[model samples]
Target: MKILGIDPGLRVTGFGVIEKQGARLAYIASGTIRTPDGDLPQRLKSILSGVGEVIGTYRPDCAAIEKVFVNVNPQSTLLLGQARGAAICGLVQADLAVAEYTALQVKKAVVGHGKAHKQQVQDMVQRLLSLSGLPGTDAADALGVAICHAHSGDALKALQAFAPALGGKGLRMRGGRLVG
Candidate 1:
């Protein structure tokens, strides 16, 4: 399964693509969409267009995005949420199923701990994907989200949801087993 992971931000949105086969993950591509200094609307448009292009080019089977964490400043959190909204719109427009994961979840999946540092996440992502060099911070976060989703046992179900337009509706679990 091919998954595109997104780490959305106002100034720079990061993207990573990975293919999962059995228990292994292969890196396809990773990069950042750096928006120039501009107004809020322009930044959001850049995020939407940039993410849409990534989806079009990669043609991923599904997508997973990092959820916006509320910051100390409510304003910052709101802006981040807007950027996330634009990213999600891109995925929905492409008819791709999307999964959302918190930052702690992503870190725990990649680094085996919820509070791992940036360098730790970067190091783990490189090791897991067998990359020779460290991915930048934002790109590594995106890849971390992809890795989290891959380990999460949801890729097939996510793709299945797309065919039926189910999105998040089909899967539920109870008592350690799938319920829907």
Candidate 2:
């Protein structure tokens, strides 16, 4: 499966594309979209168009994006959310299923720890995708988000394979847990 990941920011949005074949992942592309200093709406338009162009170029089967975390400054958090929303709009417009991952979840999936620093994540992402060099911090985080989705996608498929049996038992998975 081909996957595209996005790390949305008002100033700089990062994007990465990878192809997953069973247990292996191969890097396809990674880069950042820098918006000029200007009005908020224009910045968001840049993000939306930038993301759409990436999607068109990569044509990923699915996409994953980093979720916006609440920042110390409420305004900053709100702006980040807007950027994320623009990315999502692009993905959905292309009829892609978008999975969202938190920074902690992405770090744990890529680096095996939630507290890993940026360099650690870049190192792990390089190792995982067997890249020749380290990706930029924003691009690395976007790749991490894609990696997380790849891992979780396997688990979700496994669960789906057993859905029929679980349904017979009047049980289901709710939010990653079994419920009866």
* Candidate 2 segments exceeding 4 Å error: 162-180
- Per-residue lDDT of candidate 2, residues 62-148 (tens digit): 999998998899999999999999999999999999988899999999999999999999999999999999899999988989899
Instruction: Tell me the TM-score of each prediction against the true structure.
Output: 0.87, 0.92
For model 1, residues 33-110, the per-residue Cα lDDT tens digits are 988797999888999999989988999999999999889999999999999999999999999999888999999999
Judged by TM-score, which candidate is best?
2
Whole-model Cα lDDT of every candidate shown, in order: 0.91, 0.91
| Model 1 superposed RMSD (Cα) | 5.7
